[model samples]
Target: MIWKEARNLYVNKWILFEAIEAYSEDGKRIVKDLSVINAYDDGKEALKEYREKHKKDKSREMYVYHTKNDELIIEERMWMGVRKNG
Candidate 1:
């Protein structure tokens, strides 16, 4: 479902979702299609779930968001760090 649809379905709640179809434009992550993983009353719970899922699968584009947001405008940031090779 789209962000708007998700927002409508899960009103006034925190949700953990996977971005199935998305793109970056003007330093923003625009999610076109997504799948809702779970809903929560608290943002922290959603974030916790997102972290666990992300840790298990780094490839998946997952996020925690509140349905109160009118737009799903995620700011994209470049990760700047040196990684030591194992």
Candidate 2:
């Protein structure tokens, strides 16, 4: 998974003062998104929940936390080709 966030921090009065003006014209600070990659089963479950929760969105976003074991599951949709070939 990849996430990003934006922050507002400045030093010089020139930059800071200019930023204040820009913020007033536009908007507030942006979110600073920090993301994590899960390698364990718990993380996979979290990903599952994320997928389910965001199901209603027109476009879904996902981070492939754990897919190898999922691919091995003998399910109808995914295993049909392998079974037929075998």
Winner by TM-score:
1
The CA root-mean-square deviation of candidate 2, after full C-alpha superposition on the true structure, stands at 18.1
Tell how far residue 37 is off in model 2, in angstroms: 10
If candidate 1 were superposed on the true structure by all CA atoms, what would the RMSD be?
1.9
What's model 1's lDDT at 69?
97
- CA lDDT, every model vs. true structure: 0.94, 0.28
Candidate 1 per-residue lDDT, tens place, 1-86, comes to 99999999999999999999999999999999999999999999998988898999999999898999999989999999999999
* Alpha carbon deviation, residue 83, candidate 2 (Å): 20
Error of 1 at 5 (Å): 0.7
Q: Write the per-residue lDDT of candidate 2 for residues 1-86, one digit (tens) a residue.
A: 11211111211111000111111112322212323322334554665656664575525322332332222111122224444453
Candidate 2 — which residues are off by over 4 angstroms? Answer: 1-41, 66-86
Q: Model 1 shows how many backbone clashes? A: 0
